[model samples]
Target: MANWVRISSRSIGNHIRKRMNQGFIGSAVDINKSSGSSSALHGGRTVCDRNRRYLNSLPWNRATLFWFQRFKSTVAEKQQDSFLSSDTDDDQLSLDFPGGKVSYTSDMNFISESSQTRVPCYRVLDDDGELIKDTDFQQVSKEAAVKMYSKMVNLQIMDTIFYEAQRQGRISFYLTSAGEEAINIASAAALTEQDIILPQYREPGVLLWRGFTLQEFADQCFGNKADYGKGRQMPIHYGSKKHNFFTISSPIATQLPQAAGIAYSLKMDNKKACVVSYIGDGGTSEGDFHAGLNFAAVMEAPVIFFCRNNGWAISTNVWEQFRSDGIVVKGRAYGIRSIRVDGNDALAVYTAVSAAREMAVNEQRPILIEALTYRVGHHSTSDDSTKYRQSDEIVYWKNARNPVNRFRNWVQSNGWWSDQQETQLRSSVRKQVIISLIGLDIHNLHFFSDT
Candidate 1:
């Protein structure tokens, strides 16, 4: 009787076939030419060479061997032709497989660092707040533009006052969307009232834009009797069912999968709306991010994964987070359409999100947007960003790339906003925030004792 090794061709063939399909048409074993060990042998025979010969000598089906050899030669010849033929369309040089069509490449090269080949950020305005020549963006009417700017200003002032209150020990904790005001307000402006918003802690601007009043925000933050959460949740974990905005949570990336489910629910009900889920660059590192994106893609859910890549996750810098080309590329891995945008450019963010929402709803597919911005403030009241990063870096983003100032510049260039109007808007917003805080303190004082 012959000694027999039960070879599972199903598994082995699948593995080798997958490798071959990926453009690996070379020899199975490589000779160590650099070490001058090409001829080196163990027990008078090279290990790989001996194993190959032994495998070939097995009593296998002749037809199976012939088929594999033919397949290998055919793929190798086609790959060579593709490389040598200048007239061949690059798009045509692809291998159709179970997953998808993979483009063929002759060079065995690993992808370089993301920094060397970073995705270009989409921008409508320069750092000086002037529109880029021939820039394509969704045009905003003066009224709508003014409203967007006012909401942005309102959000900025609210963040400033709330952060100060936290510092003064009036609030237990707070998260300010200081440099990220545009990302919040602009994205909110692009969505309809029917759209669902699943926000991280930094997206109170969405609530404000959706008509959550200053008094409401103050109530929630102060956790007064008028607070929707009734003091059960922490400050800044705001939610308004009336506005279709889900409650904010402290757990990182937990909202991602929830967004997918909500979008799928909307799809099932045949609603003409999509879900917008927001996250920080640091949140993308969570396993929930992958699960959420995969779930949305697999379900063909109408959802937009909005990533605020502000270059930090608390103390962790983005470089230390991942090696990929930021958060946008992760969308591609999950088969979701993605784009990178200038988070500081309000028009750019609004335009990108407007188009993204349309595509997501019409095509019933997931979209990922990475808004590249900087966090000018500390991560939260508990964090001191200066401990981890330079103050000059913060100052540069705060002064040069200030989103509120940039949008104000655009509106002023159009003769729609003036210094007088700016002064009035700032004063009025500050007064509203201050009044709301004062009212909340008085209400809490009486309400706390009664409760």
Candidate 2:
């Protein structure tokens, strides 16, 4: 016997190939049974002290050490009994290291069931906002639905005004979230304020959901003194420590690795939160994307690599971006759970990310989500999408397949909202945007310029 417990039914066979699952991470549980609490061990040394020394002795950093500390704190008495009695997949092993060999199970199996068949994208709401037949509809409360809708509408208003502002030479740059706003707001609604968000520049809806005001957005975009980054960052490269969102970096796929490190820290402290990193389809080409996901998988960091595959990675379509089927397949390569969601369907995105977050935080593991949607507007204020893509394609998405309209339809059908409410909401948001745009830095309005 190897004195180990291999938890069964994993999509990937054994996250730890030999050592940790055998008796490394699970070692604390063995000691936990004999002497409870933070009491002393056989050498009259405190359990915490011994644990720290033991972890430090291994090839683990302070982050891994902290993960053990936090896990040790939360291990329940029932868990101890289950560990003591269970014989689920205990097996001996053999390993060749730099110095010697250890006894272990030579047989290994990968659960191909997860990836063998075609994994369908999860969808709860249709374009008409009607629930699909047999949809285990993840119900959003009236209050939550309203809040999410408000945020989505807010994103729309901000995008329209900001895009116009850029055209009018009021600002140097702007990026409209457009069709992806539902994905942004709904996902944020599913998460707590404490969960760190590493977003692309287009995900201002997440910030708004976390109480990042329109005025703050204005200040940042204008590079005014009131901006939190002190005018150092470019427009839309917003960050708010108070909101728990990392500053948006322009470099593709950089945030994914940073998110991995952040999640590892959270695990070390045993916080009930996960990091969600957003990236575009083209970003998958970056080496950091692979490095970040692979590192998170191996280290068992609690993070979510959210791929906002809006059909294009700034003019390069998804077909040209990757050879694989989609971003979800990449998760299987990384040896973790993943999902493909209907990015235009707010309910679907919310459900998928919520479940992913639960698994990430509770299991201290990583999950990837590939959101299948389209970028309905220009890549930014600089690039003209019309030059590369067809006008009909644009009309199809913006008119017939608008996510905000789809969600609004669902809300109306459920009696959560009405035509009057929708009208009033739109009117209010437009007025509010106008007010915020005009009221911002009124005394120093001249300070804003294309320069």
Encode model 2's per-residue lDDT on 1-451: one tens digit a residue.
2233434535322333222323334433344445432322223334333332322122223433333333331222244345334243433344544434444544786655344565688999888989999997567899999989988988997888878888889889999999998889999998998899999787899999999988899889899989999989999999999999899989888898899988987886569999999998899889999999998886788899999889988888888877677888888787768999999999999999889888888878899999999999899999999988999999999989999999998888888888888788877676666557657534443433321
lDDT (C-alpha, whole model) for all candidates: 0.82, 0.79
Candidate 1 deviation (Cα RMSD): 16.1
Query: How does candidate 1 fare on TM-score?
Result: 0.75
TM-score of each predicted structure versus truth: 0.75, 0.75
For lDDT, the strongest prediction is 1
Model 1, 1-451: lDDT tens per residue? Answer: 4344535777665544443333233343234545533221212333223222222222334322432321222222344446445443565786665544567778899875555567889999998779999999999999999999999999888888778778778889998998999999999999999999999998999999999999999899899999999999999999999999999888999999999988977775569999999999999989999999999887788899999999999999999988788888888777788999999999999999999999888777889999999999899988999999999999999998899999999999999999999889987777778778765543343322110
Off by over 4 Å in 2: 1-118, 440-451
lDDT of model number 1 = 0.82
